[model samples]
Target chain A: MSLLRVDDLRVRFTTRRGPVQAVDGVGFTLERGEILGLVGESGSGKSQILFALMGLLPENATLDGTIEFTGSGPTMVFQDPMTALNPYLTIGLQIAEALPKGLDPATRRARIVELLTRLRIADPGARIDQYPHQLSGGMRQRIVIAMALAAAPDLILADEPTTALDVTVQADILDLFRAERRDHGRALLLVSHDLGVVAGLCDRVLVMYAGRIVEEAAVDDLFARPGHPYTRALLATVSSLAAGDSELATIPGAPPDLGLPIAGCAFAPRCAVRIERCIEARPAFRALGPGHRAACHLTKTPGTES
Target chain B: MTLLSLHDVSVRYRLAGGVLTAVDRVSLEIAAGETLAIVGESGCGKSSLGRAVVGLTPLAAGRMSWRGQDIATLDPAARRDLKRHIQIIFQDPLASLDPRMTVAEAVAEPLAVFEPKLSRAERSRRVAAMLDQVELPAAIADRLPHAISGGQCQRVAIARAMILGPELLVCDEAVSALDVSVQAQIVNLLQRLQRETGLSLLFISHGLSVVRHLSRRVAVLYLGRVVETGPVAEVFAAPAHPYTKALLSAVPIPDPIAERDRHRIILAGDPPSPAHPPSGCVFRTRCPDAIALCAEAEPTAMALPHGGRVSCHRYEPSGQAPAPGLFKEDPLGTN
Candidate 1:
């Protein structure tokens, strides 16, 4: 059985302007010990799905559909560690707060130190008493990861955990995630706007646009043979140091506003290979290959399969 | 001819606990119509260098000349005139813009201040033309910053900065906040503008990929010092300094095969506090190629064969090189 399965997940926010459909009919299933990447730009409803699963949405937000999990509740590693961590409390205390209840004070302290040490934090004994402000951005992020792992949860949700960190530090954090998955056999749902991060870590990938899942495929397959025009454009836009001096391909238009109702496909207006039917009817997700699906009208036609 | 030149420039800030050297002695020159990128991690003084160029931060030492004239000794009127030639665009577009002002008004403010002889109609026409250059629609000119999207707001910011017809534009993380597609558009627009107007750009960013795409020459900064400076292609292809190598290795390539197969140099521990930098060398604490000589004396900038300079004790002038197999074993492991 899948470790976690989300079906028809929808999130709506009631603002003064109107009801904004932040996430529209998103669905995916994560397997045991698999690292699934939820890739999207800002306002793609990628983070909202994680928020809905964790039951941490704001008061004005409403969620629908079903989320089924076979293991304990998933732990989250937030994007900004400075805001996620408590500035007033010491690092040890904040980590201890996430541990199981009914443990003795000494045992809890020992466990906190152990978690810090495992995360490659230098001199955990001395760092335990230090506040969040005393640590660097990378250290703070490691502490947040340590707290997320304190409960030994089967699943972890990392929402752009390394976005604010430097590339060297980001590499270290990615290594830690790889180690966690390899050693503990834990499942991870990584939500990020960077394709490099997703390509480096994820086993399977889901491309989200506006508020819907436009494409889903294995990591290699997604990059090698993308089935959707939006995914193709996104991949083409990724600037690489290894690439030659060719002009970067770009999507011409911006994402549709969430407050207004979307007609047809959300990405049709920006898609280079958009068709007539793409403007009149919403494309349904259809299987192109084994474990690969794309929601695009152009995918059905011959010679257009990317 | 060199448009702007800095000789041993240093910027210091008065802190509660003694003075902080935000930008250590750094010297470089930007030629006319050239793009020079300052690449480094946070707290590396790249931003301080950008600010120092625009006279936003006072230089504690060294000489800065613009078009053969000392900028530090410029009179108030001369400084005001200099503002017309040098402009900056910040990372956060919405935060940098005045929330109360309309897009058109913000774009026209530069012309209004610099060229008081122009009529209101002329100012409005120029603003409209600038907005069109940045590809922002004229209909949204009256809308406030809060109503526009981030990409559009950034376009508006670009229009405002370029409306002054500045010869030099200091872009500090200008495209970092936008999405990938939008980032490409802005980068393309900046490149096109530079070509058409013969503009010199002092591009500051941490992303090496973006830097490689836009800049001709690259300077790598560390702890407020220029550790390496060379042609972007040469520096990227074969970095001479250890920090530059580590930084380039750390960036995750989009190709999974390359990323999985590549050897990475993961430096241990965080950067030491700038308030209490290590003696002799600021980076000796985290440098994998450090030696006893590195702690005894700071390395001076040495010229390379490819017309670049690097500062490191590993490459000594007296033919004394560090042991070959010193760091064969990964200090952080997981190579």
Candidate 2:
């Protein structure tokens, strides 16, 4: 069985303006041991989908979807490690809580220390007793990862796990994720705003905008020949040290407010190569190649797909 | 010509633990029309240096000069005038702006402080013009900061900063909080303003890619010190310091093929506390190329072949000849 599957997931929140559809008609499948990446801007509903899956959304949110997970329950790692952990708990105790109930005290402590050491926390013995405030940001993040992994589940969901960290420290945490996936055959669904990070780590990429998946492909294909205009713009405008002082191209205007229902294409207003049909009707997912698809009317069929 | 110069500047904080040197003995110069980016990991003091340059934080030591005039020695009137030329925009646009104030009031506050003699009509006209310059709609001037989007709030912040025609602007992670497309818009806006005004920028940020895109010169900081500083292209192409090379390698390229093909230099251990850094080199604890000499004595800045300077034992003018470029000899290496 697939590790997780969702069909026609929709999330709406009752707001003073109106009902905001945070995630609309989103559907995807994650096979066992597959690292999938979900990327989008602030209101793209990437994080909302994670919340819906974990059943952690607020009271105002009204969700209509079917999520089928084969595991007991999937664990999640939030963006901020400082808040994810309790301030009153010691680092070791928090991680130990994730383990099976009634685990021998010595064994639990040893396993917790081992996880910390694996994540490259120095002197795990001394750090196991330290409070979350005593540790630095990077170290605290490692401890959070350790806590998330203490249960040793098959799938992990990470939402911008390294966004608050420094670039150098982010590298270490990403390397740790790579090691975890490789060594234990663990699947991870990572949501982040950083395309660069998704490129390096994720096997498959999903570009979300306006609460819908615009494009889906293998990481290389997504980066190489993005069929959706939004994905293409995102890849083009990424600043690089090697890219000289050429004027950076930008998508003009802001994302559509979800309070009001969107008509046809959500990106048509800002899309440079939008077609007349884009406003008349919404585009369905078209298979561009093997395991690659995009929801854009402009994407030519079969001929351009490598 | 050097528009602003900082000589051996230092910033220290008295905390419960001990005195923390947030910025250490850092000397830098920004030309009249140049953008100089100071990049480092968190707690490496990039923001502190920016804060010091704009007088947001009191300096523990060293001096600053504008157009060769000592800023510290200036009388009250001259100091107030100098303040008009240098302005700072912070990372969080909403936090930097007053929540209660309408966009117009926030942008006009600077003018109210410096040019109070101006008639209300003239100030209102200038505020409207500034908003237009930042591409914000005139209608947004009356809205509270929360009513607009984060991108719009940032545009409002930019409007406020540029209202006074400041010559020197210190942008401390100004675009880091925005989304990708919005960040691009703000970057383009900053670029347009720089060309129009010849504004010098002390662009302090941890994001290397944006720094490279905006700044002509770049400085790499490690534990409150400049490990390397040079022209952006030169330093990025051939970094002379170990920390610089590792930092550059850590930033993942958006291209999948490039990322997979590139070899990464993942440094070990979390960043050490700045209160009591390592004895010799603050970065040696995590540096991959640390040698015995690194622990004994600190390395001084040495000139590079590409009009840059780096502090490392390998680049010691004696025999080692800088291993920063050596590790990157492999093909298609991002480092």
C-alpha TM-scores of all predictions? 0.96, 0.96
Best by TM-score: 2
Q: List the TM values for chain B, per candidate.
A: 0.93, 0.94
- lDDT value for model 2: 0.87
| Candidate 2 segments whose C-alpha is farther than 4 A from its true place | A239-242, A303-306, B316-335
For model 1, give the RMSD to the true fold: 3.9
Clashing pairs in 1: none
Candidate 1 lDDT over A94-140, as tens digits, reads 99989999999899889999999999999999999999999999999
lDDT (0-100) at residue B115 of candidate 2?
98
| RMSD after CA superposition, every candidate | 3.9, 2.5
* Residue pairs whose backbone atoms clash in candidate 2: none
- Candidate 1: regions farther than 4 A off: A239-242, A300-306, B316-335
Residue A245 CA error for candidate 2 (Å)?
Answer: 4.6
